[model samples]
Target: MDLHQLTIHQARDLLRKKEISSVELTKAVLARIESVENRVKAVVTLSAERALEDAGKADKALASGENGYLRGIPCLIKDNMCTRGLRTTCSSKMLENFIPPYNATVVEKLEARGMVLLGKTNMDEFAMGSSTENSAFFPTHNPWDIERVPGGSSGGSAAAVAADEAIYTLGSDTGGSIRQPAGFCNVVGLKPTYGRVSRFGLVAFASSLDQIGPLTKDVRDCALVLNAIAGYDPRDSTSVDCPVPDYTQALVPDLKGLRLGVPKEYFVEGMQTEIRDSIHAAIKKLEELGAEIDWDVSLPSTRFALSVYYIIAPSEASANLARYDGVKYGFSYENASSIWDALEKTRQFGFGPEVKRRIMLGTYALSAGYYDAYYLKAQKVRTLIRREFDEAFKKYDALITPTSPTVPFKIGEKADDPMQMYLSDVCTLPVNIAGIPGLSVPAGLPGGLPAGMQILGKHFSEETLLRIGYAYEQATEWHRQKPPLN
Candidate 1:
């Protein structure tokens, strides 16, 4: 049996029945990584030693009749999330040599559940860009076509799962970092409501907009991972105090009498014809399954969501990234005569162009003379975006849209065009603005490239979105199709 291809639920049953051991599974996964890492460039640090150790523990636990969903599962972690003693570079030279003494809250949770860490995957520097090409180490290529990008930030995690290098992986979503990549890679990625999962150990990008989520092979795995990570932590001031439901319970095939909204604003121009056709077909399938599709839904503020996200996300990022000065924990510039010079040199040498660009934009927006004109105005517009979602949710169970306007473009296709690159997240920014939940389920391929059908839901309403996505996923064969990487 190909152990690397087993989903969490499938693997758990085998482990429970003693049909397979965690060590064997881990070996199979590691071998797959070895075979594909060079071509895909998905992983940065491979924790082979640590993975084997954890797999042994899981095997012993299973031998002693101890069973857990993730106890014996091998998975990958995005580099931005701190992993104690493991290098978490965030795909930047800034922290290349820095090792955290602690694990992110999500990492700690996964470890507690018996998951084996397979090493950290690559990402855009500090999760700032739409394509993984911005990584300081190297850009992760799409497993489908090496010439194409795997989508940004969480691209490595998505590519690894698509290539079966890992059962599943964790990714952070700040303005579609998780979902967009998942969409491009033809996987399931969920961006939970902001604060539904603790951000205590996450390397911050945009604190208010940042969310940790799962990039999984299927919707069921997405739920299983979400059940393990969703909860409140006192350490995170933004953590929401709410009960996390058993997300697996939402896998029902029924969508009868459910009300779904389709905001006209999301179906904007410049969307590829194939993507549009696929989404329309998906909506039709949902209707046939008894979901009432409200085509008249309009979120007027949606037009401004991308602009608001750019302004507000950078502002928050500016504040969160201030600690990376030369004197602190990350990279530092030596041989400087003064502290000011040292700070200047460190930041100049440490941050990549994209990171520095955002910092400057944020600083400018938050400057004394322009704070009200830009930052404050963006916040007010952000509120309107949230209100729009709230009003829509009052009457609909969830909203549907294309995950990205286009399929994965060739690597370097938009590298020189910053505005074009930012457009990748245009359809997904509103969910973050409203602090709501969104899931990108693999929709049928358009022009042979994977597209995603995004389901948006109310705050903490992940169950409903999961139910909708699961039903759609079950109705189609998109999730089962593998990229032609081998």
Candidate 2:
């Protein structure tokens, strides 16, 4: 068997039947990483030793007839999530050496289920940019085409799954970090409703907008991961105290009577012809699968989402990242004459250009003179955007749109163009702003590159979104297509 291509569910069944031990699976994954990590640049801190140790434990437990869906499965984690005793660099020099004393709640949940942690995947510096090129260390290349960028800041996690470096991986999405990359890489990525999963151990990019989610090979694995991690945590003040339903139950292959809406604003002018056609075909497929589509849904504020996200996300980021000065942990400046000088010097040297750019933009937005004109107004507009989604959901079970406006672009294509970079997440940012769930599933490879179709649902409505997504996935073969990495 080509162990590298097995999904989480496939591996779980094999482990349960003792067809393959976790140790052998872990080794297979590690071997694959060793073979491809150089070209993909998907991993940041590899924990081969730790992974083997955990796999050994899983094997012993499985032999004793104890097994769960994720038990003995090898998985990769995005670097931004703190992993106890392991380096959790957010792909930046700022936290390059920072080791947390405890694991994030999601990590703890997965570990409890006996899931093996492979290693931390690369990401944009502090999860700020749309392309993985913003990493202070190195940019992660798309597994599909090494010359193109893997969409980011969760690019490494998505690329890892797309390249079969790991079965599935966890990624944090703030302003489409997870979905955008998943689209570019041709995998399944889910950004659960805000507060649906704990953010306790996740490094904050934009606190209000940031969310942790799963990027997987298939929708079933996506739901399996969600089952383990979606819940409220007292550690996260923003966590909603709600029950997490069994997401696997939403995997029904039939979508009869389901209502889907396509906002007129999402299919904007100048959208790439290939992407536009692919999404339209996906909608037609859903309709053929018994879904009713509404074409007149409108979100007038859609055009302003990019502008609003830049303002609100950076403003929160400016506040949250202030803790990274040269005081407690992380890198510190040695030749500083005073405390203030040390703080200034550390950030100036440690933060990447994208990080610095956001901080400056945020600081200026929240500054007293411009607070009302920029930050406050943006918040008001955010409320309107959220309200529009709320109203739309009342009439539609889910909303459909293209995950990205275009397929993956060549590396450095948008690196020097910040506006173009920000626009990459235009279709995805509103879901975050509305605090709703969104899933990116492969639609087709138009122009010989993957394009993603996004499904948006009401708050805590991941099940509905998954149900619709699974039906579409069953009827299509896009998810089965793999990048020609080998």
Candidate 3:
């Protein structure tokens, strides 16, 4: 068997049986990376040396009978998460060489559990775009069809898993970054409820909306990764202090008696035909699996989510990103005549077009007079959106929809049109706006690209989402369909 293609659970069983060593597994993964990294451009920094050393340590530990689920497994992380000594560039030129002095909380947690770190994957510069094309480095190609995008800004992480470059990978989602890419690449991606995972060392995009989660080959593997990373951290003031259940316990094969709502608003007009059919088929499948289906559920406030997200996220981003003024860390303009010139040039030379666009939008929204008119108004709508989901959950266990409105479009298809690109996330922005947990599972391959069924649940209701996702996954062959990469 190709070791790189094995799931985390499969690899775990073999390692514990003394059938395969972590070093060998790691090498297989690294070799896979070497063979495809050029074509896919999925990785930003490859840490083969560090990965081998970590694998060697894991092997010794496993020899002593250590059986941590991730002990001997190798995985990739989105470059936005700080990894001590390794560059966490956010695929941007500004912080191209800005290595963090400390590892992000999630990184520390994974390492503490004996997970082998393969390296950092690429992302849209500062996680700003719907396609990975915004990366200051290079666009990460979809493994399914290199001419198409894998989705972004977690594009690299999703592409890596689909290509079998690593067993699994971590991704951050502000508004569908994880799930959109997961759908595009035919994998499973989860965005835990805000604060479900620590973001202490994460390079902030939109603080209120950003949450780190995993993109994995299947629902069970997603559960395993969530079990390892979901928890509160003292460093993150927003991190929730709650008990994390063994997510594996939630992965039962049926969704019997669970009430699932199908939001009418989510099936917006102009959506691709295959996408609509796929989601409808998913809803039908859920009904067959014993879920009580609510076909006309309406989240009225959802109509305003896109506008609210753009305003609020950019406002937060403008505030959060104010630190990169060329005086502190990251890239600086040395030829500037003075501090003001240096600050101006640093951002001008460092940030990509998308990043600058968002920054400017945010700056304008947060400006003194516009604050109440734009940012405040958006927050009011955000609360309404959240309340709508809250009321829906009173009658439903989870809500279902399509993750992306369309399959992975060809690269550069939406590049020149920012509005069209932003609309790519129309279905998913509501989940983040409500600060709820959402999961995207491969639903079907339409027109040779993948469409995903998005499962959205109440805050901290990840287990329920996983239960529903796991059930749907096991009953279908979608997750088993590999991309035509090889």
Candidate 4:
């Protein structure tokens, strides 16, 4: 059997039936990683020994009749997530050698479900940039075209899955980190509601907007992974105390009368012509598959979403990153004569340019005179954005939009211009601000690069988002296309 091509669900079923051992599947993925990782640069650290050990244990447990949805499945986690004894770098030199004493909540949950940890994938340092170029270590290349970047800061996770280096991978989305990269890589990525997945161990970029989610080859695989990771945690104050739904079971819902709202604002003048056409084609396909498409509705607040996200995310980032000063943990410079000088030099050397830029921007935004004008006003705008989504959800089952404005760009194409890079996330930032669930499923490749259609649902309505994506994916062949790596 070609273990490398099996979805998490398929691999799990095979494991349960004794058709294949978890060790075999894990080894197959490790071998693939060894073959393509040099050119793709997807993985920062490979946990081959640990993954085989875990898979062996999982195989033994299954032999003894223990089972779960993700049992014995091999997967990767974004470097930002803490894994006990494993280097969780967050793609920064600051924590290059830092190993957490405990596993993150999501890590513990996935491990409990018997999922094998393959390794930690690379990402933007502190999850600060749109392209993986900001990673202190290295930039992840798109599997479809090595010259292009797999959209980031979760680029490595998306690229790894797209390149078939792993079964699936986890990513954190602050502003389109998960969905955008998934689009660029031609995979299924979902950003659950802000508090749907606990953020306890996720390295904070923006407290209110950050969310941990999955990047998989298929919608069903995404559901299986989501089932394992979604839940409330008391350790994270922002985690909602809402009930977790059976996401896998939700994938089979009937779409006959489902109302899918397509906001006119998403298909504006700035969007690439091909992306607009591709999204419309996907909508037509969904309509043919029994979903009702609602046309051209206004989402005025969405226009302001990008600006608001920049202000809020950076502002929170400045505060959250304050602890990294040469004090307690992470990288520190001891050569400086004074402690303050040491702290400054450590941060200066540790953080990348994009991170430092945001830190400065955020610090200024939240400073004494600018707080009410910038941060407070942005918060008010956020409420307006949320209200717009709430009003739309009241009339529709979900909102459909282009996951990104254009297909994946060449590496270093937008890396030099930060504002241009920020605009890449225009369509996705609104959902983050609204604190709603959004799913990005491969629509098709236009101009040879992958494009995805974004589906947004009401707060904590991940079940609805997954159901819609599943139904759409079932009728499309785009997700089956593999990037040429041979």
Q: What lDDT score goes with residue 328 in model 4?
A: 76
**Tens-digit lDDT track for model 2 on 123-230?**
999999888998888999999999999999999999999999999999999999999999999999999999999999998889899999999999999999999999
CA error at residue 342 for candidate 3, angstroms? 0.6
Which is superior by lDDT, 1 or 2? 2
Task: List model 4 lDDT by residue over 77-130, tens digit each.
Answer: 999999999999999999999999999999999999887999999999999877
Alpha carbon lDDT of each predicted model:
0.92, 0.94, 0.93, 0.91
Candidate 4 TM-score, C-alpha based: 0.99
The sequence of per-residue lDDT tens digits that candidate 3 reaches over residues 383-439 is: 899999999999999999999889999999999999899999998889999899999
**TM-scores across all candidates?**
0.99, 0.99, 0.99, 0.99
Clashing pairs in 2: none
- Pairs clashing within candidate 1: none
Q: Please state the error at residue 290 of candidate 3 in Å.
A: 1.0
Put the candidates in lDDT order, highest first: 2, 3, 1, 4
Q: What stretches of model 1 exceed 4 Å from their correct place?
A: none
